[model samples]
Structure formats: C-alpha cells, structure tokens
Target chain A: MKKIVTIAREFGSGGRYIGKLAAEKLGYKFYDKELIMLMSKESGLSDEFIEEAGEKITNSMLFNVAMGGVYLNPGYNNTLMPLSDKLFVVQSNIIKRIAEEGPCVIVGRCADYSLKERGDCLNVFIHCPDEQKAERATKIYNMPEKNIEKEIKRRNKARSSHYYYYTGLDWGSPSNYDIVLNSGSLGADMCADIIADIAKNC
Target chain B: MKKIVTIAREFGSGGRYIGKLAAEKLGYKFYDKELIMLMSKESGLSDEFIEEAGEKITNSMLFNVAMGGVYLNPGYNNTLMPLSDKLFVVQSNIIKRIAEEGPCVIVGRCADYSLKERGDCLNVFIHCPDEQKAERATKIYNMPEKNIEKEIKRRNKARSSHYYYYTGLDWGSPSNYDIVLNSGSLGADMCADIIADIAKNC
Candidate 1:
C-alpha cells in the first residue's frame, strides 16, 4: 500500500493544503514549498531564483538537450547545464530519489511526470470552480477580490505550460492522471482523506 | 474514433451544456432527458415514476431479489419486478443498446457504469466550485442565492449516492473515469471541445 501520490492542481484550489493533510494522514513526507528550497540547496541556486524559474516554461534549446538524453550520457558535465535545465534535472533526480526512498505526497512541479513510469504512484489533479477559487484566494491568500481572477489565470497558465514543456503531456487531462478530485465539492480535508484512503488501498 | 461519451456531473457545472455541445460537434446523438423517456417507453412505466426512482437508491427487498438473479430465471415475471428494479434494468439495457447503436453522448443516469464494459467509451465527470455553481444556478435555474448552497449540496448528495448504490464506486473519483474536468476553470465550451478531441483521439 506504499504509493507515491503526485498532485497537479489549479491555483487557489487548495491543492497544497490537501496534499499536506493527506501526507500527514498517511504519515508520509509532504513536498511543496520545501521542494524548491531543496532544489536551491542541491543546485547551489538561490531559493528565490529557483522559485521563479520553477514555474516558468523554458524555451531554451538547453532544456531540450538536457531532456533529450544529457543525463544518460555521463560524459556531459553537470555544472555546465543552464539554470533552468539544471533546476529541472536536479529536481527530477530528487523526485526519483525520494520515490526510491519511500511513499510521499508531492504537490505540483510535474511530479506526476517525474514518476510517470512508476506503477505504484497515484497521480491526481485538484481543481475547483473559479468563484470558489477566488474566494479561497481572497480568504487564504488575502488577495484582493479584484485581482483574484487575474492571479488565478496567471498561475494556471504558468503551471500548465511548465508541465507541458516538461512532460510533453496536457495538464489535468484524465488520461494523464489516475483521478481528478474537485476540492470545492469534496472539501480540502475530505479530499485529503480520500487520497489517503486510495493510498492505503493501493 | 467512434466512441460513447458518458458524463457524470454536478448540477450547475454545465455538464448537460457541455455534453450537448460535444455531441453536436461530434455529430453524435445526445442522451439525457431523452434517456428517461426511452426507459419509460421500453418498460411501460410512467416517466415520472422512472425519473423519481432513477436517482433514488431503493432499499426495497424486491430490488435486491431482482438484482440477485431475476433476469436469469425463467420463472420471474417482468410485471412482478419492483419499480426501482425495473427502471434500473431497463435503463441499463437501454444504455447498452444505445452504445451498441453508435457513437453518442450520454449524461447522468450512471451511463458511465452502464457502458463500463465497453472499451470504446469515455467517462467524464464535470464539476465546479460552489460559488461558480451557485452563480449558474441563479442564472440558469433561477434559483435564489440563499437557497443555492442547500440545493447544490442536496443535488450533489443525491447524484453521488445514486451512483454509489448502483456502481459500488465512489462518484467523481478520478480512477472511476478517464478524466474529470472543471467547467469553472476550462469553461463549458472549451471543456466540450476537449471532450470532442479526446473522443477523436480515442
């Protein structure tokens, strides 16, 4: 029943909250903001820089070269990697290493794609209605009501495109995920419990 | 690809709208209200009775007996079947018949479960945030704002319980369907286009 759970979600969908709760319920490690910090430490990149670059899709040919088998060829110098490519591969390696260590709950950052080949992983996407998301944004993030929609759209675009660039798969598509849960319908805590239940049954 | 698309959705998620639009784009027959009518005609039961019993989880012992093996034995008379059991079996049969006919879009009534055995079917669950759903309820159904939450919860409960009772599966679990789409995020029209694209790829 030890299964890695990867969650991809829309902005303000309570994805991070649900993932953290599920991880707690499952007694598994939760990764979200901490993943960026870990990447920064591992790559010797500033946490701020990693945070910014992490959500943005890189169009650089360097990313393509790195994804196209740079890691497979040991002759390539790791330090020579572009910042985006370095962050991507480093985070990917970390994700793989974590999966090898044990079951955990990971939120965002294309974790689903990172662990795509693992049969023991449960990939989920959490989303909600825009108005509910806006409310959450206003309440949880203390975001202005007027700016909620804009922020949501901006974040959604960044995450989806980032995922697309990395995985070559459409974000939130049913085929790419094991299940899609609407946090607004199930509630964050209940959604977490459901994910934990699935982990237990897995 | 010719495929049967089954949608399970929240009340104000614009599921019917998306299904109808997708059916139109795909040039496929749309089933929803027409399905209830079809069941009434086939089973000789009043549409009102079928409709009421359709989404209600019946506790009648007759339903259990009928489900147990009434259809297999020659001694069981069709007239003696409980109304709920009759509706269930009739609708199940109808769904199978429709799926066999050709590619089409079916909404609600647990069409996903009815067509589960078919490899050529795409199951989708549509949902929205409570606020967004409430807005839809107000505009579309003319539901008062004060009563919107109550109505949404009530309808959601009925749909999920009906699905659970019939399919022995959790409603809206991503594992149960190929994909779950949030209308609040993707919008109704885009969701339909995405479903149509998936159907085509299928």
Candidate 2:
C-alpha cells in the first residue's frame, strides 16, 4: 500500500477537497494550508511571506534571466537565495519530515516532486474543465473577479509557473503523476474514492 | 454507470491490454483493431487500405495547407475527401452505432472524441514513462528497432498528429478525457481496476 499521497492540482479543481476526503477515508493525516505555518516556524520567515512566496514567483522569467548573474556571483551571493527558493527548501524539508512520520496526504507545494524519492508515494494531479472551474470559483469559493474564467486562467498560470520554477518539471504532465483525474466529470467524491482505492491496491 | 469506455493511449502504454482486462471485468465488448475491418465493410474500402488510413494521415500538414483549395472548391471537390477523413467518418459512425447497442470498451481511433455527445461515455487516456515504454517495446513486443525509444516517440507523434488533424484537440490532454493513467506507476492491473471502478460508479 502507498504510504504518502501527494496531490498536485489546477486552481479550483477541488483537489484539496479530494485529498482531504481520501486522507479521511484512509485514516491518514491531511496537510495543505497547514504547511504554511510549519514553514514559517521552520524557516523563521513570516507566515504571510511564505504563503505568497510558496505559490507565486517573485520575479518574471525575463527578469530572472536578466538578473541571473546577481544570483550566482559570489560577491552578491551572501544568503542571496530568493524568498521563493528559500520557502521551497524549507517546505521540501518539512514534506520530507512529514513523509517520514507516517502516511499522509500533502496537497500542492510541489509535494509530488519533493516526495518522489519515496517508494510509497502516490502522486496525483487533478484538473477540471475551464467552465467547471469557473463555476466553482464563483459559486463555491466566491471569487469576485468580473471575468472569472480569465481570473481562473491567470491563477492556473501562476501555479504552473511557480511549480515549474521550483521543480524543473511541467506542472500537470501525466508523466510526473501516477494518475490524473477530471473532478468535473468524476465528481470530487468518486475521485477521492479512486485515489484511496489506488493507494490501497497499487 | 458509464456504459461506453473510450481509451486513447500513448504508444507502448499497454493501454490495449488494460482495456481488454477492464472489458472482461465489466463484461463489456472490446473493440480495437476490429474497427478496421468494420470500416472497410462500411466504406467499401479495402481492409488493408482502411487499416493504414484509419490511424495515419496520407498528406503532411504542410501539403494539406498548401492544397486546401483543392479539397474545398466545388470545381475541384468531386468526392475529394481525403482517405483518412473518409475512414474517420466510417469509424465514427460505427463507434456511435456500437455505443448505441450496449456497454463496450473502445480503444484508439479517437473514439472518445467521436462519442463526445454520449452521456454515458468514459474517456480515458493512458500513458507510460518513455523508459518503461521502451523496455516494453524491446522486451514484450520484440520490436527490431535498434533505437526503440526513437521509434516509440515517432509513433506517438503520429498518433498525436492524427488526433489533432481530425479532432482539433490535443491528444493526452487531461481536459479532453475523464481520467488519465500512467501504466508505468500504477501497473496495468491496477489501472484496469481503477478504470472499471470509475465506469461502474461514475
């Protein structure tokens, strides 16, 4: 049986909810937003800063490319790691520590890539159609953007960018995940059930 | 229950074997290469010709673009539909007719896109890691290619191009399918079990 379950998902795909449900079904500890506090405690970084830096890139790719020398130059490199990179290091350590503790569900924060070395990790990616995600953003999350679809796309892009920046892997590629599911079609409950079943059997 | 299960797969993913196992578990009819003969019978095209045309494109995309007018202009059109397009129409009709009859598993030939209007269809995309696929090709299939990985990639590209040319949709994108499985991670048996479970419950 798989011991560690990592869920990487698109924005508004109900992946966190599915992870929580699957964790509950399997009697495993669930970790999502709670990791922000842990990162703050471990890294001595402010919770607010960690929260933002954990899921968003501080600089555009162009800016990073233009300023690459500043990050690598020894003269400018005294603890010169970007906040996002710092948060990623802290978060990855925490994820590793958590995996060492017991079976648990870790959502987002590139946990899939972080725990990839573990033999018993089941990594899943959850996605839904744009319309379904927009509906969820408006109806469930109460997101107030005028163009919810555009907002959804923007958020998804941010998440993808953040993931790729830290992990050097495409965010939602099937090769990185054991299974990928469409929550809009399968519904959150069935997705959780399938995850749990796979965890037990595979 | 999802009565129609359509599987679109990457080359050497063992998707066909998974589909067959799922069909056996669900007691559903399995259709794969058999569609070639059916298309031949329906279109009065030779089985050999249909077999080649059903899964491959005759003209390159550049050639098609350069010669678009020849296919569209009434003066030049007299049943000028490309052989692939003709095969697609026949195969889609047969897919629709099969879905109408009863629960069944259809593998490849873009059945998922063909049965988009059906409420009971479960569209799945199965993929595997390149190394695993290469291993399968060399060991199980006994392929003679010295560079098996390159051959596998070529075949996958062909499948992707054919899918995009006909359906105007990207192959192996999670948004286009209900679920996507990595046979390398989950193994074929567990993948089939997950598919059958989803078909029954969702």
Candidate 3:
C-alpha cells in the first residue's frame, strides 16, 4: 500500500516547506491550506472563513478569555458555536476524503487524529523555539517583529485549540504524536529527512 | 530534572524485563507489577484483586466474543467502578509522582501516555517477532506448544483491549510511539542499553 504522511505543526515551524520538500523527495501529493479550500468548496462556506477558523477552537487566548471564549459572537452564530462545529465537521469529512484518495503529505488540521487507525500512516509534529518562530515569520511573511510575536501567539493558540477540540487529547504530547521534531534546532530539511527515513522504516 | 522513561509494549514482548534491566543500568527504580501493587495499596484495594482487575481488560478482549466480559453486579458497581477508574487515575498520578521524585523505569500500562508532557520522559515501545513470543512462552512459562498459538492470540487480545480501554487510543501503532524495538531480534540487554542511551540523550 502507498504510504500516507500527516504533519501537524506550530506556525512558523516551516512544516509546510518541510512537507513540500518531503513530497518532492518521495513524489507524494502535498496538502496544506489546500485542504481548507477543498473543505470550503464542499461545505459551501467561504474559503476566507475556513482559513481563519480552520484549525482553531478560539480566535486567540486573550480575546477568547475576555469574550468568554466560545461565547463570543463571530457573526456566523450568536456565539459562532454552530459555524465552528460545522467547520470542524467539514474539515474532518474533507480529511477522510483525501486519505481515501491515496498517499499524500497532509499538514495540520489534526489529520493525525483523522487517520489514526491507518496502518500505513506516519504522523509528525513540528515545533520550534519562540525566538526562531518570530525570526522566521518576520523573514518569510515579511511581518514587523512586534506583529510577528502576536501572530505567532495567535497561530499557536488556534492550532492548540483546534487539536484539542478535534482530538480531545493534549496537543504536542509525545503520547499523541508519533514523532516530534525540534525543527528550529534541527533545521527544516533535516527534520524532513528524519521524517522520510522514519516513513521508510515504519 | 531527572529523566522519565515510559515503556509501552505488547504482551509476551518481555517489556517488563527490559524495563527492569534498563532501570538497573541507570540506577532508576524498576516498576512493573510494583506499580499496580503500589496503586492498590494507595487505593485501599487488595493486591490480588486489583492485579486481576488492572489487566483484566486484556483478558476480556481475548475472550470477549466467547464471554461478553465481566461486569460487576449492581451492588458492586459503586466500588468496582472506582477501582477501575482509580487504577488509571492512580497510574497517571503515580507516573507524575515518580517524575517528581526522580527518574524511573515504567513498563506497560501506557506509562508513555501518562508522562506525555514531561520534557525528560523517553517513551519507548518494545516489540518482537510472533514466533519469538511462541518460542519464549513455551520455554519460559512451560506452556504447551499446542496451546502457544491460542495463548498468544488471547494474550494480545487482552493486552490490546486493556491498553486501549485505559489509554483511550489504539495500541501497538508504531506511529503513535517514539521508538519501536524488536527485542527478540536485538536481545533484551542490547535493547536495554540502547534504550538507556536514548534516555540519556533525552
């Protein structure tokens, strides 16, 4: 059977680039935000909304806490409760659809939890230090340094909440992920190579 | 902080033996049945009964189709349910307790799941060939050769069920573990040494 690789990651961890490199190296299809777009098409929701709410349970911690978290009205619902739920279901359905298609590299959106029972799947989590994240975000996305910090915090909050909402398990726990990579310390290419080797062995 | 080590394994894989050996090499406490015994003592349950119940989930799975599984009578429900729940809660609590005390070697019962958040914890899964299990079971336990196949299947059924029930996740999935070792191929001592080295690095 062809192999399925799922990559869950922190923002600015270079997971997308690493996944693309892995796909190119092994000649596999890559899925990232592309998955969100597909889910949007299927759910009849706008891609922009999916992009913003795709992998998050809350907007950001500060606002979430200030506005009673899930109680805040994101306009889709008085509290966005319905929209968030539908968005996750849509993403989950889309995830299974992609897994059914064949071997591919999936980035984020709790794809690991979606494909847990597949014997051929390899789940990887990519993480890096805060400083490294700020540096990378500033360099790649061309954001101001101060804004990079806020952006990093926002993305991480979203990723954690998204995973928690879906998997109902602690995110980044070594127990939840098969392999955890220190991408900032190891370098993205090295992390990708490690994953590729692990895929072969696994 | 002292390192933590978690060993997840299949039944008849000699996981406990390897864990003990690794602990000895590193001067860490080796906990196998000792953990159950400790939990029983802490929870005020008899050791024998708790031991039977602690791993009975495995036994149930093995014989589940034939025997629908053990359910405590309505009167015993209040007590036995807490026993079962306490087994897991105490297991998790003890793991955290041990990590707080110092490094320790924990075998089976999903210690890896228990210590997922500890930075120093080295989670490992010990595995071996099926044939090796049959060979060892017959030689070590004096099991009849004819019954070895049945024993292996039954034990695995129980183990997977036990692990899954407590961990709330699929068991024996390589991608869900940090490292997988073929102890039957590598030899237990070598496996222990290699694991010890890995633990040191962690």
The local lDDT score (0 to 100) that residue B36 gets in candidate 2 is 73
* Better by TM-score, candidate 3 or 2: 2
After the best TM-score superposition of candidate 3, give how far the Cα of residue A34 lies from its true spot, in angstroms.
Answer: 1.9
Per-residue alpha-carbon lDDT of candidate 3 for residues A29-142, written as tens digits (9 for 90 to 100)? 899878877998897777776776777654355644443334334555564554566667678778888889977899988888888877677777777777888988899978
| Model 1 chain A weakest lDDT span, ten residues long | A66-75
* Tens-digit lDDT string for candidate 2 (A1-202): 9999999999999999999999999999999889889889997877776676677664564544443412322334464654456567779999999999999999999998888888999999999988889888988999985989998888899999888877788897888999999999999999999999989878
Judging by DockQ, tell me the better candidate of 2 and 3.
2
On residues B82-106, what C-alpha lDDT tens digit does candidate 2 reach at each position?
A: 5456567779999999899999999
Instruction: Report residue B192 deviation for candidate 3 (angstroms).
Output: 12
Query: Model 1, range A103-153, lDDT digits (tens) per residue?
Result: 799888898898878878877798887888999999999988887798898
Candidate 1 or 3, higher lDDT?
Answer: 1
What residue pairs clash in candidate 3, if any at all? Answer: B58-B158
How far does residue B32 in candidate 1 sit from its true spot (Å)? 0.8
Q: How are the candidates ranked when ordered by TM-score, highest leading?
A: 2, 1, 3
- Candidate 3 scores an iRMS of 8.2
Tens digits of lDDT, candidate 1, B102-169: 88999988888988778788778888777889999999989888877998989888888878877899
Poorly placed runs, candidate 3 (over 4 Å):
A58-81, B1-202
Better of 1 and 2 by DockQ: 2
lDDT: worst 10-residue window of model 2 chain A: A67-76
TM-score of chain A of each: 0.88, 0.90, 0.84
